[model samples]
Target: MFGVAGRISPGPIGFDVTMIAVDQPTVARHGLTIVADHTLGDAPDLDLVIVPGGITDAVERDDRVLAWLRDRARTPTIASVCTGAFVLAEAGLLTDQRVTTHWDDVDALRERFPALDVVDGPRWVRSGHVFTSAGISAGIDLALHLVGVLGGPDLAVETAHRMDYAWTPTIPEAPEGPQRGT
Candidate 1:
């Protein structure tokens, strides 16, 4: 939900060349605002950083967000949903990392970030510091995965069952070797 960059749109007042902000609240509700300052992950700091994504071109190039993401990298948990993978990828955190995103965005994500082992249709992925989800709907699944990892199996199971949900990840075939995290 941390949208560091602003959304843009066509300008009013006959200014065809200049654009206007698209009222980020329209897109990022729940008390959205520009991040005035400060890098993330100083010590006595963040436990987990969640980057939820939106427009691609704008987010990929944001300097502030990228720096924070890189800072957050050394911290314990860094997770993303949907196109937020763009933020993590932009930070180069995905180098040699296997990750996932909304199913439709994976190809372009890979095209934009070749260093990442971006899979085709997985609901999510967890590799080292990065945890990503395909949550084009299944964000809850991804969140549950984090809950399982952080809180242990029983809490995760209870959480999922509370929603009357079954944990069904779209796992791509594990690579040629035994799985690394298992």
Candidate 2:
């Protein structure tokens, strides 16, 4: 969905997106072969950074990846989906920030980074220049929101309409009391 979000073009609100990785010829968790067209050393100055989550442990253990993220944390916007929040937290970019991730990993995120204000039940959360989303599909919603912010609400709506997508702009309130573990 990162590709989809990056390709969203509603009139003049189009984005020029590029994919980068710590290494080339990486395999996705689902067995998809991803050829890294750009490495961190070759990345252009970026206005936005979106980190998609999978196999968080491996990403956390890669010093090169962590250093690259730490360098890019100063970008205009940085976002993560699902377990990608772990990467941001590990990079010290999420300290004292309210964020959310896949519901199943909320507790783990909080435990791993006690300084982070990990929110629950929100499809997405934005604190300063950082954004995070719940799970897979939620990343699209967060991207649309970013589109609205970067382009305009009209363009975002147009993009969603063109894609036949249902966009939810508001975060719903979580039910009171203790939440069950996923």
Candidate 3:
């Protein structure tokens, strides 16, 4: 999704993305080995921080990662994909906020973070500067939404078009709670 943002015509959307990890040579759940660009201590200040979802039980237990997230909470935007919401909640960043996760794990998120308003259905939810999305593909939608917010609607549309993705322009509005983001 972000690849589309960095490869648009006329000019690329300006974003210098960095991948950080608690440790180098991290292996994903599916046996994918990822060599991170930086460790938490070495990462530069970021305007936006995105936490990806997968098997996060281990991450939820890592105090170092949680502490790093807490320290980076002052970033302009913090987002999570799927069950990555659990990590954010564990770090106390989702307190008193409405959030979402993979539909299969919605109950778990609600149970674990009783203080949060765990809503289901929306492809993504944006409360204040924190954003949460449902499942893997929803992260793409959230990414596009962020591109629209950080860049422009037109740029987002163009990026979507370039990627051949059917992008939805509006965020679903819930009957109660804050207005869904544009």
By descending lDDT, how would the candidates be arranged?
Answer: 3, 2, 1
The sequence of per-residue lDDT tens digits that candidate 1 reaches over residues 49-148 is 6677666667678776577667657756677888888878888777768988888788898898888889867667888767788855556677656555
**Judged by TM-score, which candidate is best?**
3
Task: Extract clashing residue pairs from model 2.
Answer: none
Residue-level lDDT tens digits of model 3 in 1-182: 66567556245346666899999888988899999889998988777789999999999999999999999887877899999999999998999888999999999988888999999999999988899999998999988888777766777788888889898865423322211111
TM-score of each: 0.66, 0.86, 0.90
Pairwise TM-score winner, candidates 1 and 2: 2
List per-candidate RMSD values in Å: 13.6, 8.0, 4.9
Candidate 2 per-residue C-alpha lDDT over 1-182 given as tens digits, one digit per residue, 9 for 90 to 100: 32443466434444667789887877889889898769888988777888888678989888888899999877877899989999988888889889999999999999989888999999899888788999988988887777667655655676677778888654323312221100
Q: Candidate 2, residue 45: CA error in Å? A: 0.8
Give the count of colliding residue pairs in each prediction. Answer: 0, 0, 0
User: Using alpha carbons, what is the TM-score of model 2?
Assistant: 0.86
Q: Which ten residues in a row have the lowest lDDT in candidate 2?
A: 173-182
Estimate every model's Cα lDDT from 0 to 1.
Answer: 0.59, 0.77, 0.83
Cα displacement (angstroms), candidate 2, residue 149, comes to 0.6
